[model samples]
Each structure stands twice: as structure tokens, then as C-alpha cells.
Target: MMLSTDNHAPLRRTPLYGLHVSLGGKMVPFAGYDMPVQYPAGVLKEHLHTRASAGLFDVSHMGQIALRPKSGRVEDAARALERLVPQDILAIAPGRQRYAQFTNADGGILDDLMVANFGDHLFLVVNAARKDADEAHLRAHLSGDCVIDSLADRALIALQGPKAESALAKLCAAAPSMTFMDAGPHEVAGLPCFVSRSGYTGEDGFEISVPAGDAERLAKTLLENPDVMPIGLGARDSLRLEAGLCLYGHDIDTTTTPVEAALEWSVQKSRRTGGMRPGGFPGAEKILAHFDHGASRRRVGLRAEGRAPVREGALLFADATVGEPIGKVTSGGFGPSLNAPVAMGYVPTSQSALGTKLFAEVRSQRLPLQVAAMPFVKNTYKR
Candidate 1:
């Protein structure tokens, strides 16, 4: 599925573009910009380096949205957002982040976003491909006094891997203690930055939000650590896939609901089945039904045999069934850490059990696969 794009390609650069090229980055077109797909280190080496040490990524293509309400009642604005997403945004405390997806009237996902209540306004980081769609959706349905301000001048950077914390801790003005999924603004390298104890790689890391102009300087300062090296988009994709994280357009879309993606736990029961604060939001009925019953197609992890990787669009067949194909691969690649191929996709609920055997059609050959629990690689999230 192609992401909607405007007449103008809308390709823009982050402050780190020059720095990336200086480090011998292999640039590619991603989310409509000149982005580094891999550095001179290559995807394999970059992936291993990040798993072992620290990798700094320039993720400025992701959308940064701020909701400034007339009343400045952040909770009220959060309620407006909660009506759109599955996460408990209204009840989220300060200095915390919630991963949520916007659903349409039919309970299908429109876009996935990270909402942060920044005291005065509701902050969001949206997928680059879905930025326009997400912004329009928010603008059309927002409550009174809410205004959507897309922070185009802001840049986002992620420092991921095991040694990420110690490297960043040196620059932070104060020792900002953080748990997984936590977020706070801090002074880094004598410059103010919004630091979140979160990342897509399933590793312990932080996403730093800074002014666009300052991104290059801050990135340079952070990469001063011997353990820190410039990572790129190629490693990012493989890392997240190995960690069992979904990519928005590939793994989820308008027809994919939270329940089908195995994200039912993201919606709290209290808000789901109409607890104290009932879920009276859009697609609540469908979401609740899926919660009470379940979805027809459920996303699961599959461990494939041999060195061959089953990529997205590969049809899944349970026990060699011809007419009834279970599902298709969403994201799949060779996992360096596991030394085997890993893939994730949706399959019928009956066959979603662990150790269930299945077949993935790769070219003319059908490769045998075993249904396994997700996070094919162990998640090192600080939580």
C-alpha cells in the first residue's frame, strides 16, 4: 500500500543531513526525504553494533505535533485525544508517554502515535508517512478550543542500545531518573531538550526532541562517546522487526484494528468495557466486542527454518490448507542475534497458539514455520 503524498514530494532535510554524509552514510529516499539507510558500516554491522554498544539515529522525519488548547487544560485536550486512540491518555500522569493508534468509525487503525502530556499542551509524535492524514483527522474531530500545531521546525533523535543511558547522562544538566515509557524535558549539553525513556528497537534508549537548528550540534556532542556510532534506517527496520514492533503502513493500516494486531492490552479495561470512565469514543463498540470476544485474524510471531527469510506479502498456510490461507507476512528478515530468520504476521485465532506449525510460501517453495511468542529477540526495555 502506498502512503498518500502531496503534489510536491515534500522531501525535507533534518539538521543532521550533512553530519550523516560526513560519516559516509548511504542515503536513500524514506518518508519523502533524503535519509541515511545505512552508514559505511552496513546494515548487518550497524545492527550488531547497536545491540552491543550505542547507535545514534536521525529520526527527524517523524511528525511532531502539539495541541495548544485555549483553556490550557491539558487533561481536557487529552480526553479529546483519548476519544480517538486506545491508550489511556486522559489518566496518563505527567512525565510519561503512551503508545496509541487513531482508529476510524469502524475500529480500523488510521495511524499510530505517541501522545505526551507536556503540562500546557498535548504533544504527539506521528509516523512520517501518515502525518498529513493524522493531522487532518485530529483537526476534524478535535473538541472546542483545541488547535493542531505541527512542529515542522522540531527534530527528533533517538540514542538506542545498551550503553545509551550513560552516554546521554553526561550531557543532561541534572541526573534525570527515568523508567521505561517515561518522558521529561531536560537540559542536554547545556541545551534544553525533551527526553523520553522510550524507543522502537526494544532496547533501553531515549528519544530526544530538540529544535531543528540545534539537532546537528546536539547529535555531534552525543556521538562523542566511543561507544556511540551513527546508525541509519536500514538497521532501524531490522532492529524493530526483530523486537516484534510493528511498522505503521506495513503491519497496520485502515483495515487493521488494535485487537487484530494483538494490541488489546493497550486499552485499559476500565476504559474499554466502560468501567468508571467508559469508552464512549469512536469505534468503541467494535473495540469492546473484540475485547470481549476476539478478532478473526490475530498477529503473531513465526520462526522460519533455514537461512531463507520470509518477507512481507508471503502467504501463510496452516497445515497445508489451500483454500483458507491464514494470513500474510507483515515484516520479516534475517535476525542476526538469533542466527535464524524471524517474521511477524496475522493468522486465524485457532492457529495462534505457541508451537503451532505452519507453512510460509516463499517463491514456489513452502517453508515450514513454527508459531512462537513475540519479541523473537528478548526485549531489553527498561520497564
Candidate 2:
């Protein structure tokens, strides 16, 4: 879920807007775009359908950018980008993508993004709400070394589920061979597109970036498959929540650091204190300190003891009668796959151990919850 911050700005429409409307999608404003919240199948069935088969998502509102190095070398672009994110962009091999975050000088998260090495230039897919700020950040820092090209004419769609590979393979012969995180240009449905064997859903899938003009045709062709269905933002949120994936602005934001967010995995050893090129990125001091020592708070998975879904912003406490909120839920909902209420939140490291019991205040009642392992539903990524 994308949130609309500015109510005055006219909502932008994606290339597949017509298709979504024709398919009976419930339109809503999200991140300044008119996006589908759900279809006639409703969020529950759509979420289950994706887990059982394939689900197509219109993620065209996301920003796609190309970082072309002035030296005509991909390494230069990678190195330039490394200055912004904590991830080791220099080691990313061609046709592979890696998740990363942009950190602030105060060690807070600016935004999280995916960086793909395209051999010649670096490709970036950033959150819709932060795209403008992200582009401005790049221009402010790396303008002299790289050329930033915003791919506004492109539309991004995700085909995700157990049957994603088979469905995509019918159109793109190379789909089956692409492993997790593999990203590159390919002929998808007779249209030149950038295809990545990765998605927000924990299921095996592909995120295809196509030209605006051909997006609707490609989507229609994909939906022609018996196993594929058009998914909306509602199911997308619940699906990702069940998969233990983070949603920008909610689960993560400028107030949260990558270390506190339990995203230290994205920070490679090469960027750590002892490595060859360490501590150059923004907030290296504070972030690395958290790595060397530890963060006071940690993001953990929560399983509500009862049926009540502990939604975001619910205060967490040590007991049913609480003195103060120790933390707050960042993302939470009923997991359709798990058939239970699941949530994620930050808490004191002391209270973040697995199986540690806690309580969440909801509607004047402090309900019981436990610190459980993530991915309430098992992930099916083709790793």
C-alpha cells in the first residue's frame, strides 16, 4: 500500500487503467495515482488465488530510472549509487538485482529500493511516493558522475504465484531459466520488456517492465491464461503482509533505521567497518555503530492470540495492564494463508525474542500477542 499524501494533486493513471476499469476494478487514490484496490473477486479470494495460482498486479505507478555513468562503465554507476545506499552495489553481477535502502545522515531510512545491474547502466525501481525525492537526491549527489534518466513512459506489472513461471513462459521462452533476482531485457509477449524473476509476493514470480503503449495488450494476453488473474492493491497489501514484506512509509520510514528495521542483511560485509571500502555512505557512523554494538529496538513478527487483527499503530505493552507503550505495530492483518492474525512491530531487543509474550492495546482492551517468526505463510521464492 501506497498512501495518497496530497489530496489536491490530480490522480495520474497508468497505461492499464482502462483495462482495470473494464475488469471491474474498485478504483482508489494511492500515491497520487488512480489505482485498483480490488476487483469483483474481493481481497480474500484475490489473495488466495495468487497463492494457489498466478496474480497480475499493475505497479506502473512506481518510478523506474536509469543511472548511466558518464564514463560509460557500469562500475562507475554502481559506485556512485553506493554512496546513497548501504548495499554493495559494486558486487552486483550483470542481470541480477539487489534490495537496498537510502539512509539519511541521522541513520534514518530515506527509502528502500531495488537496484539492478543492466551491464551498461544501473536500473532502479523506487517507491511511488518517494520517487521524486529519490530522483532529486541522485541529481544532487551524483549528477556530475552519472546521468539520471527517468523512465516515465514505462509501465510495470507483476505476475506472481506458483504458476507464474508457466504463465510467463508461454509468452517469453526465457522465463523458466531465470532464477530469483535475475533481471534483464527480453521479448515478452512479442514486446520488448525488462523482465525480473522477482516480486513483492513471497511466491515465485516475475515483474515485467514494458513500454506504456504495450502494457495493456501484454496484460490482456497474460490474463488470457486460465491461471492468471488481475490483483489489486488490497490483496497486494495483505499478500505482502502475510509474506512478512515491508511496506514503505508504514513498516519503514525516515524515523526507522535499516538496522532497527532488521534489514542488516541488505548491508553487505564489504560496506561494514573492517571492509576495504567501508563507511562512505551517509549515516555510516550511527548505522555502523548499531551494527558493531546493536540497536535498542528490533522489528519482530507478532501473532495475536485472538482473532482480532492488530492493525498498524496499535501500542504494544508488556502486560494487559500497561504503564506505557513499549512499541507499536507497523504492519498487521489477518493472514489468509495462515488463518491467523499476524503483525510486525518494533520492540525492545529484550522483548523481541521468539515466543516472548506481549500485549497489544486495541479498542481499550490489551490483547495478548507473541513474538513469532516471520513469513506467517511460507515463502515460495525460486531460489
Candidate 2 ranges with C-alpha deviation above 4 Å: none
- Quantify all predictions' global Cα lDDT against the true fold: 0.85, 0.94
What lDDT tens digits, residue by residue, belong to model 2 across residues 1-383? 56687889999999999999999999999999999999999999999999999999999999999999999999999999999988899999999999999999988889899999999999999999999999999999999999999999999999999999999999999999999999999999889999999999899999999999999999999999999999999999999998889999999888888889989889999999898788889899999999999999999999999999999999999988948999999999889888889999999988999999999999999999999987888889888
Residue 119 deviation, candidate 1, in Å? Answer: 1.8
* N/CA/C clash count, model 1: 0
Best by lDDT: 2
TM-score of 2: 0.99
My TM-score estimates for the predictions, one after another, are: 0.95, 0.99
Question: What residue pairs clash in candidate 1, if any at all?
Answer: none
Which lDDT tens digits does candidate 1 get at residues 1-383? 12335547766777789999899998777777778988988989889888999989998989999987768788888877877877788777888888888988888888888888778887899998889888888888894659899998889999999999888889984434787878877888887788888899889999999998899999999888899989988889889988988899889888888999998777877677757766667787887888889888899999996789999999999765465577899889888878889999989998899999999998877889989988988888777
